[model samples]
Target: MKVLVTGAAGFIGFYVSKVLLNKGHDVVGLDNINGYYDVNLKYARLHELGINKEAASNYNNVCKSTYSSHFTFVKMNLEDRSELPKLFETETFDVVCNLAAQAGVRYSLENPETYVDSNMVGFLNILECCRNYGVKHLVYASSSSVYGLNKKIPFSTDDAVDHPISLYAATKKSNELMAYTYSHLFKFPTTGLRFFTVYGPWGRPDMAMFLFTDAILKNQSIKVFNHGNMERDFTYIDDIVEGVVRIIEKPTTERVQNNELYKLYNIGNNNSVKLLDFIKEIETNLKMEAKKDMLPMQPGDVERTWANVDALIKDYGYRPNTSIKEGVKRFIDWFKMYYT
Candidate 1:
């Protein structure tokens, strides 16, 4: 099947796209390659996929640049409605994995408009393309943060997500709602995956794992948010990609005509780990003690998050296997090699 993967330069996007390529699917990747973090990391991810900075310097989308035959990439912002539709029309995708968005909770507080433009406006454009192009399955990334300030131990899809503390979480929740509306109106099969704290090799710098690793390596104090009281379901990147593959291959069937095939699942380890414990794992792996600056929780930050991925397991047999200690070790090892 011909698959379209948005945010192909991103951590999850790169891993997922590689999986698709390995499976022998024709994939057209799209990403703006913004300087949200280090632009070099994005380019590095692209380079791993056979695209270089030279080919991805401007906004023009590059096609078939990789030595591998099955994958291609385009440099385009999803919010650019005009060009987005054109690309979708030309590609005529069978499956589209929409992972593109303005990520980071703290960043959302600083730049709320970006969340609106990319998460809301950009996602709307993707939905329009999926509907118009007759795409079979649209698997999107929804965040565990969408559970918001709910006082729940294990966040479930059945739980109400009305109180989003951060603009980022609100946008993710909004994506699920918009997808539901599109699925109802156009009868498109849309699956929204509520990703927990995904951490592993090639993870984003804005995320905790990378930040802590970098800080520890530099012998700087890592801010232990919520005074080290926070807990997160730090899932491995491989597990997240596995769930995505399972759903994309098996597009849900709408029970009746004129209705869309729509479902949502929480993809995570289903187990939460403390911030301090997570830090310890990183510190141990790197053989360096972390200078911890324990601090109160910032705005848009949650006390804890644990995903109840029972629905995922039931429907798609989603199994997340990487433990926090093991996952952190893998990341630290990669960080040492990549940086050195």
Candidate 2:
């Protein structure tokens, strides 16, 4: 199958593209490589996929990977209505895994327009392309943050996500709605996977796992938000990629829940680990204790998040079994190797 993986330079997107290429699928990776975090890290991810740094950093140019002949990459934004559609028309992608977006809840508070442009407007373009082209399945990245301030113990798909505290979450919720509409009107098959706190090697620098690990190694103080009173269903990277691959491979055969080929699932490790405990795991792996600076919860932040992945399990036999200890160890191992 020919697949178009948006945000292929991203952590999840990078891993997903590699997996698909190994499975003998033709993959075209797309990313603007914005300076949201670190462009070097993004470029390094592309480098791993055999893409040249010079070619990947350029705009609108397609670079064939030196790593895998089956993988090609384009440096472009999702909001580029002109270039995006041209690629779609040329590739005629069978499956589109739309993982591209301006991620980071706290960052959204500072830069709201970025969220709207990428997550909202950009998503509309993807829907338009999928509808226009003969794309079979459209699998997108949603967030557990959409659950917001809900007191529900285990956040489920049935739970009301009407109250998103952060602009990032709001845009994500908006994407789900937009997907539903496109499916209803044009009969486009779409799946939105509400990912929890995904962590592993090649992870984002802004995330808790990466932040804590970096600070600890440098003997710097790590910020513990909510005064060490937070819990997250931290799913491993491999498990998340597996679930996404399964959904992409198996297109929605029938209408789901009165909706025309629209499906949403919580792709997460069903277990929520306490923040302090998660920190302890990182400390254990690095063989060093982190200098902690307990802080109050920042605005646009939730106390806890726990995903009810029963639907994913039932539908796709999805099992996110990587423990916190193992995941942290693997990340630290990669961090040491990469940094050194």
Candidate 3:
């Protein structure tokens, strides 16, 4: 199948595109290649997928990766409706996996408009494109942060996520609701995946794993929010990509035994680890202890997040198998090598 993967230069999207290419699927990847963290990292990811620095950084037309003839990339933002439709008209994508978004949970406190434009408005455009282009299946990213300050031990898709602690979470929750509406109205099969704290090699610098590792290696102090009391269901990159590929391969059309096509699931390890323990793993991996700075939890931060991925397992055999210790070691190894 010819698939259009938005945010193809992103952490998850990069791996997902490579997996699709390996599976012999024609993948036309899309990203604006914005300076969110480091454009170099994004380009490096594309480079791994056979897209060189010049091609991935090119902003005009789509570049076919020299790595895989099956993979092509467009440097376009989802908010740009004009250029967006042109790509849709040209590619005529059969499946769409939307992973692009303004993705910092804490940053949303400072720049709410970014979330509004990228997550909300940008998502509307993707839905519009899929609706207009006769796309079969649309799988988009949601977040476990949508659970907010709920005291629930294991947050389930069945749980009410009406109260989101941050604008970022609210936008993700809104994406799920909007997708459901489009699915019902246009018969568009959409799946909203509520991802847990995903970490692994080539991960985002904004993420705790990367932040902690970098701080430790540089001998700088790392802030421990919520005073080391927080817990997260940190799913690994390979597992998250695997779940995504499996879901994309088996479209919602096949899962619909009756008439329902829209589905939402929490994609997580189903194992929550304390922030202190997670830091310890980093220390062990780098063989240096983190310079600790204990602080109160920031606004828009949750004390804990544990995803109940039973719905995902029941529906699509979703299983996340990487332990934080193993995952962090791999990340530290990558971080040292990449930075050096």
Give me the candidate number with maximum lDDT: 2
Count of residue pairs whose backbone atoms collide, per candidate: 0, 1, 0
Ten-residue stretch with the least lDDT total in model 3: 251-260
Of candidates 2 and 1, the better by TM-score: 2
Q: What is the lDDT of residue 333 in candidate 2?
A: 95
- Candidate 3, lDDT over the whole model: 0.89
Q: Mind giving the per-residue lDDT tens digits that candidate 3 earns over 35-75?
A: 87998899899889888777666675778788888998888
lDDT of 1: 0.88
Q: Candidate 2: which stretches are off by over 4 Å?
A: 254-260
User: Per-residue lDDT for 255-298 in model 1, tens only?
Assistant: 32536467899999989888888888887888889998988889
Model 3: pairs clashing at backbone N, Cα or C within 3 Å = none
Clashes of 1: 0
Q: What's the TM-score of each model vs. the native?
A: 0.97, 0.98, 0.98
lDDT against the true structure, per candidate, is 0.88, 0.92, 0.89
